[model samples]
Target: MPASTSKSPRVAVLADSDTRWKWGALTAHRLVPGGRLDGHLLRGRATPTPRQLGEVDEAGVRPDSVTEVTAAEFLATMARERYDVVVLALVGGGVQAMLHGLTHAWRGRERRPVVVTGYVGVVYEKVTDGLLLRHGADLVLANSRRDAERFRAVYEGVGVDASAVVEVALPFLGGAPYRPADPYTVVFAAQPSVPAGRADRAYLLERLVRHARRHPDREVLLKLRSRPGEHTTHVEELPYQKLVRGLRPPANFRLVYGHMGEVLDRADLLVTVSSTAALEALHRGVPTAVLTDLGVREALGNHHFVGSGCLVSWDQIDAGRVPVADPRWTQRNGVAPGDAYGTAFDAARGRIAALLGGAGPGVIAPYYDARTAPGYVPGLLARYHLGVDGVPLAGAPRADRPSGPVRQVVRRAARGAYRHGVQRVAPVVRRLGEL
Candidate 1:
């Protein structure tokens, strides 16, 4: 904790139940040990699994500190306690809870100190107003500096007054075990496809399997980490391992579960089709190939590892291998290029404290959508009129028009040829020996 003259400020950390609490909470503790940091687990759609519940129950938060609260309860807790700071380190879907807390403030008697913090990517900038700025977000924190800069650019471009955002890096384990030298290992962490990233995954995985077939002796290992509640719509429809089973690669495939860190520890080459796991592998001195280029080239730019190889496409995988020991494999310590995994919560707390001159913490009330009353479609639509809620909405748009006749014909021919090629290689994927 920073040396304080008076009693340390009490900080309440909002943690989501779906994620691991240790990393976020531990980091908060490093910032404030006696600061009354509490973890509030955001309830998910399903009942918490045994492991999920166990992780929460085992966090050892004091009875007063540990509470399973809904989005409504979060603002109530803030109002009742009027905490000095609220650190929000929630998962992808928990932003609503933060909005609820803000709504509570909007409706209630007091404002709560709050920091809006999370790992949400640029995709969320649409639904959230001013990316939580207009709703009392004072400071925004992200996972990397790059993301922070991106957030700032996007936020300011739309007139958000960017001074409120800060990017604090997660403490990545750099000296963690390195891959064993020699006998280069191709490593990839399999994510059950999600509709959002599935097309890229299928395209990249197909190309990877095709490449591996040419060098049957090369050792490649694909690992999948499964925990309950980690749902993907596509995975719910078609599980990943089933697809892996379909890819019966010859001599170079091993499927394993759990112990991902251990598995990556021995990998000399790491490949990710835009998975954050690539970052983890990179930290382990494994050369990372960020496969961000697919059909959606214009929508998303290539993700380049700083000082490393250019963002690679599936066709370039073979020629793109770089040595893990090269200087390009090294990255700066602390935050890379994104906003804090926990942005609004930390900002709310820190900025509120700043605004209040370290007096009573600023209070952030709850924000709610009337349930009994019909969903406020008009009220929601009004936000679009004001120009905040619909930012990210434009990123992924619907293309209703069918492909032009010529393009459709070309696509059909390409699909036929691609299917023929895949059929020719389908037998190859079916055997560990053929690869």
Candidate 2:
């Protein structure tokens, strides 16, 4: 990689889902002000659809180009592109697999691009395992002061280098400060799988409808991430849309979908189970709540908001109680009231700049190698259609495809079928097995 291109630095982001793509694309623009940014979306079960991309691209991060690639195909494209920076906005396993695969593919290269990886939102589970899985990159972005501290502890505790951890805030956290729209709006940022059961999801919807009835003067909006046939970052077994079918609500209550920030424009209160939208709402100074009615459990992720003072029950919310976030908690978690968020990415930008201007960073050395992760590594890479040798499997797609309309349609149909199986067929089959 002795600088194949002579102009501005090249940045390529490899993303898996819509949320990661939004974070990665926005991060690229933040890291390199004018650098050419291209995107690679891994072909998978959760690959962002055209509609989903359009939803998040409102941040003005529509990439110069977006291509679909498998793990081996991405590596092959990396060999030819000679990018200045590569961002891995993927799940933990995907990041680890790509790190090892890239290490092998770029062996003995004259120079290598700086690699980056990080989480999309609050890290509420599998702290050690997830951090170590994303261990090997030039920089592993920590989205808050607390996250940075935890990340450092995990790396040092395991005898790994902790210098790569850099503090940064969520990239998509900018919008007009809350001005309080007329009629006083309430928006519930729905989660796909936080509750992960039809009973819980339906109960929540019933509560929302009841709330609308309780306060007819105030407008209530259910902000959904995707429709019935679509997939998002998480597997939505029971969409709120499906649950709302059996309930009749007042005209004042409605379901809406678009950019989260746009909906925040009219919101006087933001409520969620544990979606990242709560942080976004806090960034824009909207009154926010993390529901505790389901119990403050790690499984629901509401426990992460315990000290934030945003936790409240729907019973409390309906009783005219407004939740206020703790300032110390907000600052610690990177919500940083006022001008602090404007500088959240300053450190990240400077770090990337130094790496680009100075000597190249060393090779990508993931924590899990064949010897270290003998029981797990092979299967993980195999799912991406990569062999134990880190080469493309015989039947795997080996090149990045700017897919045509027909291919796109077929891909959509295949994904719809997979989601249907997860949501419908599997549960019945399991029940039958039990009987």
Candidate 3:
């Protein structure tokens, strides 16, 4: 890389792994010219996926564009190369690390644009690029406007610049529309986070099987979604035999694994708890029932039956006969399908464009339509504690001491320890080897 006196907006994106690197590379290729695109992947020991390798090969992005390095390594590169913008796609603890480093680097130089994608599962509450922006993220592109607004609301007191919050529709949501035969068929969508119904999921599966058995003539469907390598991890634990043993399963009780668009075609009702699949079902004019707890009910508000009908609790399903598809929900939420879709799309795009430093008319265009994400973060955090997938604590937890100075000292000390731990370990290990 040489210092040329030019005004082109060159960007350096930080990816977590090769697969992430490929996505960043492709996005840059579409948005920025070749010479302006620079992609750096975090130096993780994880092996590159086949699809990732394939994407890299097809894209023909040079090896120079995709270097493996630590956050510090990439930060040094950004400083040396002088990137105009930085797009960070890493999630979880990686998100915090990127924010810390970028904040430090930005403090010393001219302000550079910082945009991050927030698509991780809702398990980690209050942890997002939304949180990063508080540290100094120029823009945080949420998957939807509802999410973007929620981000703004969540960080209201934190003092992050609100203008930089945008919501863009996720690339995966570009699925085909779903239309059922008579709006009477029902589909139970499966999520990766095993539903917390009954002590054992097998018991719940048995209950669902019994429901299918009772309604032998009605169409019953089960659609499951998991990541590329998660099939084996999730499936082996599921009780397939007991759940499907006795009765001849209904014609609609099909096991859907991938590509939700195809399975949603004949589904009149979609059932799930806290899965974004419900949003997909809503977009496709299918009624949805979130059969979990009251928390989900509270987050989504009362209109469960929009394009679809919603039943909050499993007991409500039996009492209300939700799979039957209530007509009121359909009429209210799905009155004018095309017009509604266009409006939702427009709202999402406008919010996203505004966050990304763009303006009104162009932001609301069809190509940038962002859909709302049906996620409840507070509930997720309540269910899953912070230690495993959250910010690492120093000597003592933050909750133990709420005083400003105490908390700040812990955070600063933790950061210092993390930064120097690798250096400290090298010498002691070398001395032990001599012994």
Give the best candidate by TM-score.
2
Model 1, CA-based lDDT: 0.48
- All candidates' lDDT scores? 0.48, 0.86, 0.47
Q: What lDDT score is found at residue 179 in candidate 1?
A: 45
Which residue runs does candidate 3 get wrong by more than 4 Å? 1-85, 103-113, 120-124, 127-135, 143-146, 169-171, 182-185, 194-200, 216-221, 227-252, 293-309, 313-435
Which one is best on lDDT?
2
Clashing pairs in 3: 167-352, 220-252, 220-253, 287-308, 287-309
41: Cα error in model 2, Å? 1.0
- Work out the TM-score per prediction: 0.61, 0.95, 0.53
For candidate 3, lDDT tens digit of each residue in 1-435?
121334665666776654345545544433344447666756443323344544455445543455545455565565566654466756444544455444444554543443444443232243444354233345455545455667676566554345555554433232345555663566776643354332345555655665566666657766654333322111223334334556466564555544455667777667775555665666566667767543444343323333344555666665645543454543333222344433433443344334335421111011000121114322222222222222222332222233367754764565445434433454456669979
- Model 2 agreement with the true structure over 1-435: per-residue lDDT tens digits: 233385777899999998898889988888776788889999888898788888657877767898877787789888766888899999998888888778767888877888999999989998898888899888899989999999999999988899999999988888899888889899999989889876788889999999999999999999999877777888887788878986999999999987998899899999999999999999888999899988999999988898999999999999888898888899999786688877888887778767767777777777777878889889988887777667667887747556679987998888889988988898678779979
RMSD after CA superposition, every candidate: 13.1, 2.0, 14.0
What order do candidates take by TM-score, descending? 2, 1, 3
